[model samples]
Target: MTGAMVTGAPETTGYGGTLAAEAARFAALGWMRGTSGNLSVVTGRDPVRLLVTASGLDKGELRPGDMVLVDEEGTAVPGATAAGKPSAEAALHARVVRLTGAGAVVHVHTVASVAMGRRRPGGIAFRDLEMLKGLGRSAHDEEVVLPVIRNSQDMSVLGDRLEAALDPGVPAVVVAGHGLYAWGADLREARRHTEVVEWLLELQLAEERGR
Candidate 1:
């Protein structure tokens, strides 16, 4: 947030190492199996340039150089240094950042998220849970409906639906039949939000099964 938004691609990606580490952690949890998920960090604001994890590489084995610089449209910056291609979902990630001003984004394929996306495609409501505070919501007597948007192969289509379904108060969104996307002021906060939302979704699924 300190430097001005550079109009061109940055020569060095200062966040690659951190993002690689985070991606490995998520991969270890089985939330980012194979190359199924991606992590991104905002490098600029006004123009919204970000460093996103490269596509088709095992998230668990990502190196510091395994990333690509992309613009708001998810197109790789022409002169950006990159070890691989940008993830297919980069556009949606950019959309989230543009809409929310989030500093970082985490996308993962968690079982709980996929299940809830299918079970509650419209949306899933959470209430009266202490964990709600983790998502910046009141702990008690509060209801939060996490948006669930249908998935699409085209990032534009997916981004459109996500824009319509987004809850400004909610930092996370579930892609029905696909996965979860979470964001925050930074990578740490984004990761925390991702974990909290996933946990809440798991609890919701359990409650439904018990009833």
Candidate 2:
């Protein structure tokens, strides 16, 4: 093993392109702006490599090179370059991927999610919503509880609580006073879940305000 150094090979160019596109799209939709959100897509499975947005970079301005490759443990692989350190929520993303075997994770600081999470005394409950089908539920009549956990600066503690609170079948969760975390079998699916959950939360808020 003399003169041998561990290094990470470059991720497929296609993966980087897809990551940048999604980041830009989300940013444009106002789901992730001012570098307030994080997104990741699994690139490889055997070694569990993922292309994730770098911390502190405006999602709207994300370039192909702004994405970094990290392993399942949240360790940055060598040769990957980004504008800043990985998102502080990297650990939480890794936990969700490990638990759900998800291919992608999208986190955002949408106004609806933040407001709903804070106003709801317990957690977010989605029932009889046709949009629920987007989250893999076959019927809209079922109640889907999107667990809302207290936000914390400590990543480890937050990750632990998120893992414990997440229901096996649910595709998303909200962090009280923070934002939402959504995941799916792939990037597109994850993005859809984010949109659906946000819509549900906004509807819930309107209903509450009217009451």
Candidate 3:
């Protein structure tokens, strides 16, 4: 395909718009400060194409233009006028989507997530919280474990580690000393999982302090 070739992306739809809005909101909360996080939403499934944030762009300033459409292999669609490069961790997003049948994925570097992951390298479990309902967990004392894997730069290695550690039932994974990865059937559900997991970690921190 020629460099001038343009691929079809969601122009009329607001998928990118929603991601940008959430990126800005998370930036305000320091979840994605300094462009430390990445977000993606699947645009097409037949050829497995998704819109991922560009590498090194400030999440606070995240906009649709900062997103690039890429296929499952992390290659930019042949006919898209995409100027931004897909995130370096796009492979991870691809894995999450494929493994979980997710339509969207979110990765964020939040203090509480990093802290909790570091504290429990294996994983952390939450229970007795009403917010657990957000994850489809019973609001009673049922336990929900969010998997944690050691942080690694090699996408292949990290992918393997995540595959082994991830709990299929959970919507997110914590990267020790790194951050969290959340996904769902769509952007709205993915964002909800991200928010709920982050909230649980923050609450855990507060509760630990009281001890």
* Pairs in clash, predicted candidate 2: none
Cα TM-score per model: 0.94, 0.90, 0.92
Q: Write the per-residue lDDT of candidate 1 for residues 3-41, one digit (tens) a residue.
A: 454343333435778888999999999999868999998
Whole-model lDDT per candidate: 0.88, 0.80, 0.82
Q: 1-211, model 2: which lDDT tens digit per residue?
A: 0011213322336665677788889899998867899988877777777778888888888776777777787777765653456877877888788888898899999998999989873788778778888877755667888899999998888888888798988888899999999998888889888988888898998999899
Query: TM-score for model 3?
Result: 0.92
> How does residue 142 of candidate 2 score in lDDT?
78
lDDT of 1: 0.88
For lDDT, the strongest prediction is 1
Q: TM-score order of candidates, best first? A: 1, 3, 2
Clashes of 3: 3
Model 3 residue 150 lDDT score:
93
